[model samples]
Target: MKLSISRYNPELDSRPYMQDYEIALVPGDHMLLDVMLRLKQQDSTLSFRKSCREGVCGSDAMSINGRNGLACITPVRTLHGTVVLRPLPSFPIIRDLVVDMTNFFQQYHSIKPWLENPEPPPEKERLQSPAERERLNGAYECILCGCCSSQCPSYWWNPDKFVGPAGLLQAYRFIVDSRDKATDERLENLRGPYRLFRCRTIMNCAEVCPKGLEPSHAIEKTRMRMLHVEASGELDTHTPPAGRPSITN
Candidate 1:
């Protein structure tokens, strides 16, 4: 099969380029990552990231056929012809199929991903009712692969300011947790023109998530919760002018 993989070396080449390869598909070559491994044998210089190879580590995420996905889970048989692979889009390329994830991680860290409860700790782990726990269903499955956030155009434009989908999904994860006590503070932190409101709900984040999570939905839920707080006067904010749509919209 013909494969076009992006190649780059700061020490040698000035810019990125695609290098084609023709490899014989072997018996164990079931996923895209398998082909990548075979190609690696042919050219040791080819650079990429892979670990766990089970879609859990989320290390092998890249742009396959113009869509961001984890190579470990993408079936080779599902690809058509001349499979094209590249680093995640709109990210600074560190090398072939590898990107600088510093900005992505910075936005993620800004959300305060862990649970916050200043109240007295429980003797055991904090327990939640079954229904309360169920609120975290879709938000808890994010693997921080950078697939959703990298594909988001808002993040592409405002990588530093926007929390992006993955971070927002993580933020909502703690916000809806029954055991968390800092939901208001978490929402307040996201209060700004760019941080959370920049999401256009384009659904690209939902489309490329390897874990089938809906980050756009999570972003919408966050927006709704913010609006609820604003309406209740719980947050120090002003009402929108008459006949003018609120920025939260």
Candidate 2:
């Protein structure tokens, strides 16, 4: 089997280039990450990211044959010929097949991924009914992989202003939580010119998600929540409650 991987070294190469390598494949060898590890064994300079060696951790996400996916779960046999590898699109490359994720994490953090409860703490864990918990089924499965966000055109164009699909999906995760007390504030935060409105419903984010989660759906739900808030005349006087931290980027 042959693998053509994108390579870049800030210390040497001024631009990225593709390098090809030949590998012997066996019946047991399937995942693309395995092939990458084997290639690394031959050349220690080759660099990429992988953890858990499974899809659970999205560290191995890259553009495989021009499509974004986790290398750990992609079967090599499924690829027709030489597999082409590149870093996630619309992100600054740190090195070979590894892109800087600072902006991605910052957008995620801006949405406040954690639950926000203002009520007094209960003695035990905050309990949610089975039906209430089911609302988070798809949204909670996201692994923070850059696939969806990188595929989003709005994010590509406005990486700084737009929150993108992954962040919106997580925003929905906290907004719909039955125990969360900051639903209004969460909706208020996203009600901006470039934040939630930038989504054009292209569905690219949903198509490229490795987790099969529909971030587009989550984004739509968020838009609907925004509409509801607007219809209720809440935005005119909406303010983030005290103690809620502000996110700059």
> What's the lDDT for residue 127 in model 2?
97
- CA shift at 148, candidate 2, in angstroms? 0.4
Which candidate wins on lDDT? 1
Error of 1 at 89 (Å): 0.4
| Model 1 lDDT per residue over 187-216, tens place | 999987778888887889999999999998
Candidate models: Cα lDDT each: 0.90, 0.89
Candidate 2 residues lying further than 4 Å off, grouped into runs, are 237-249
Query: For candidate 2, which ten residues in a row score worst on lDDT?
Result: 240-249
TM of each candidate vs. truth: 0.95, 0.93
Error of 2 at 88 (Å): 0.4
Relative to the true structure, candidate 1 has a C-alpha RMSD (angstroms) of 2.4
Model 1 misplaced regions, further than 4 Å: 239-249
